[model samples]
Target: MRDRIEKRMAEIAVIGLGYIGLPTAIMFANAGFNVTGYEIRKDVVERINSGKAHIVEPDIDDLLRKVIESGKLRATSNPADIREKDVYIICVQTPLREDRTPNLTYLESAVETVAKAMKPGALIVIESTIPPLTTVRMAEFIEELTGLKPGRDFYMVHAPERVMPGRIFRELVYNSRILGGITPESAEIAERLYRSFVKGQVFRTKSTVSEVVKLMENTFRDVNIALANEFAYLAHQYGINVFEAIELANSHPRVKIHVPGIGVGGHCLPKDPHLLVWPARDDFGLIRLAREINDGMPLLAKDLLFEALRTINLPPEKAVVAVLGLAYKGDSDDTRNSPASAFVEAIVDDVAEVRTYDPFVEGTHGSLEEALRGADAVVIATDHTVFRSLDWETLGKLMRNRVLIDGRHVVEMPPEGFVFKGVGRGEY
Candidate 1:
């Protein structure tokens, strides 16, 4: 089986062609495998077939075009197209429910689709971010659906994705991967498949550990960012700049501190902490606290905006505020659980009007001029590179009032004639 896969005879079907799935399918196809992308959205399927991507990521367009033009990759909404694939990889989402529990609805659906199509001796891999023991439970689920026992009749492995949005393509090749399988043989086979394209180390472990490792990586970042956010709050009370203090402290070799923003966002950071703590035996007090701190950042930003408004003697109903960015983080357009979205939700009803603009995000204002025109205040939600070098003088001229709120702390201080306030900076 390994030899056949290495020889490019194995057909790989990647289910759910969203952020992770699309790039992954493209990578495998570029590596000489016959790849089929299964998507529930017909528009996504059509776009990929037409060599266009539905999601925005850096350098994916040319890669998608090359893979499609090479005849190695195609997408379909029909499950029948994936019935005979040699390898089945489930890349669907595993988001949290409203109660902050692990939502396995999408994962279960993906498993059902694979169960209907998979044959004996076929390898099944899950690349979604799920809680510990989910891979084993999914393996049991496949057994109950198809009456095929894992490791004997079929293979199962958990290989959660570990790439950020903006650098997904590059990290997919270079990043070290964790492969946790139900059995040693399952791990070995999946390792061979990933080794084909992965330039970094492929570490093998039990399926549960791989799940925990993925959660741990994201949770660590979340906790650290939460600490930074707390520091920012403390700095505000002390009337100091948190960025300067963080830089000076981080100068020590071991004291690395993350930057505080309006809030933590994106699909992973905001939700993964909950996944880690939801199933744990203990209450996970620290983890819960960290989530709360990060979650409160949007409200903190709202307070800052209101304070700026009061300083200028403008009422909420009379303020025309412009929100700068909507995507969770910088450059790329992935807005899942975005802090900018929360900030907008928190203040949209109170403000006279809220205009939004993002350079890379669609359905926003056509130009910055439109969003900033006649606005009394502008909130820099996401730290997109374009937002860093804005001509504040010219843009401020277009606004009715000159108030700048830097939620991400990416903007410089005291725009010559404008009233400026940043997340961590005390006063200016």
Candidate 2:
């Protein structure tokens, strides 16, 4: 199997061509494999097959077109297209339910599809972030479905994606990967497959540890961001700039402080911490508290906007607020679990009118001018780069009143005649 894979003779099927899966499929195809992307969405398949990218990742469209033109990559919604592949890579989403429990429906469905379609000796690798022991349970589930023993009749591994949204393509190749297999042999096989495109180190381990590692990486960030948010609240009460204090504090080589924002958003940070505490028998107090603090940040931002509005004697029901940036983070078009959404939800009913604008997102205002037109207040929710260089004089004229609430602290200072309020900077 290794020899065939190394020789570029292995047929690779990447299931669920999402943010992680599409890039993974493209990279593998670029590395000389015949890659077929298996997607449940027929439109997505059609888009890719026609040389269009469904998701916005930097430089992915050109790469997708190149790979497709080379005949090394194709996308299909049909299950039969992937049945003959030597490797099946599942890149489906593992989102959390409303109660904050891990929702493995997508992962389970992908596993079932692989089990039904896989031939003997085929390898399956899960790139979705899942709860600990899920890979092992999935291996067992596959065995039950196919009547074939793992590590013998077939192989399974957990190699979760560690890339950020905007930099997924670069990170997929450069970031160190964790290849956790149900068995050592399975890990080795999985590592060999990744080595074709991965330029970074691939650490081999047990499936459960790999699962824990992915969870830990995001949980650590969530906790630190929660700490920063706590500090931001304290700074607001004390009338100090949290960003300035954080800068001075981080001058110490050992102390690292993450910047506080409207809240922790995106698919990973908000939900991955919940995965850690969900299955634990005891109360994981810190983890739960961190989640609460981060989750409450959107409301905190809402309060800041209200305070700004109160200063001008404008009630929310009479104010028109424009929310800038809907994506979770900057320079990308991913809106899953976005803090901007939370901010919108918190104030939609209270505000007289609300308009959203994102440079990369659709259904919002095409231009900042349009979003800010006739607005009484503005909230910087996502802090995209385009927001940083706004012409304040022009924007002030476009608004009914100049009330700027910087939720992410992206703006350094407000221009003359504009009332400025930020998350941590009080009366500055």
lDDT digits (tens) for residues 135-230 of candidate 1: 999999999999999999888999989998889988999999999999999999999999889999999999999999999999999999999999
Q: What TM-score, to 2 decimals, does candidate 2 have? A: 0.99
Estimate the TM-score of every prediction: 0.98, 0.99
lDDT of 1: 0.92
Query: Backbone clashes per model, in order?
Result: 0, 0
Candidate 2 stretches with Cα past 4 Å from truth are none
CA lDDT for candidate 2 = 0.92
Off by over 4 Å in 1: none
**Model 2 Cα shift for residue 371 (angstroms):** 1.4
- The residue-level lDDT of candidate 1 at 14 comes to 98
lDDT of each: 0.92, 0.92
Per-residue lDDT of model 2, residues 377-428, tens digit only: 9999987898898888988999999899999888998677877888878646
